[model samples]
Target: MTLPTITVDLLDSKAKQTQKRQLAKSLTKVLSETLGYPDKEITIIFKST
Candidate 1:
């Protein structure tokens, strides 16, 4: 199965590392459960500008 690539772009440049990590984790869990995607196979890329 081809895993989906999830990219999250943050407009706030001051976002903390912990916050970003938490967001990624939350997104991963939701996607995995809702989309039946494996947590390990899911890819999340975060970009801050």
Candidate 2:
């Protein structure tokens, strides 16, 4: 299924790759509950701008 765009803007800090991955996962969970969608089914794009 096609999902809507997900955009998050924040200041660029000293976040590592693993930490970013975890943040992405957590965001997915939040999205699932907020958007009524499963994390596995949603396509997410994480951008820092």
Best by TM-score: 1
Give candidate 2's error at residue 9 in angstroms.
3.2
Give candidate 1 regions above 4 Å deviation.
none
| Clashes per candidate, residues 3 or more apart or on different chains | 0, 0
lDDT of 2 by residue, 1-49 (tens): 5775566555776777788788888888888999898777766665665
Query: Among these predicted structures, which one has the highest lDDT?
Result: 1
TM-score of each: 0.86, 0.61
- What lDDT does candidate 1 reach at residue 33? 97
lDDT of 1: 0.89
Give the Cα-based TM-score of candidate 2 against the true structure: 0.61
C-alpha displacement of 19 in model 2, angstroms?
0.8
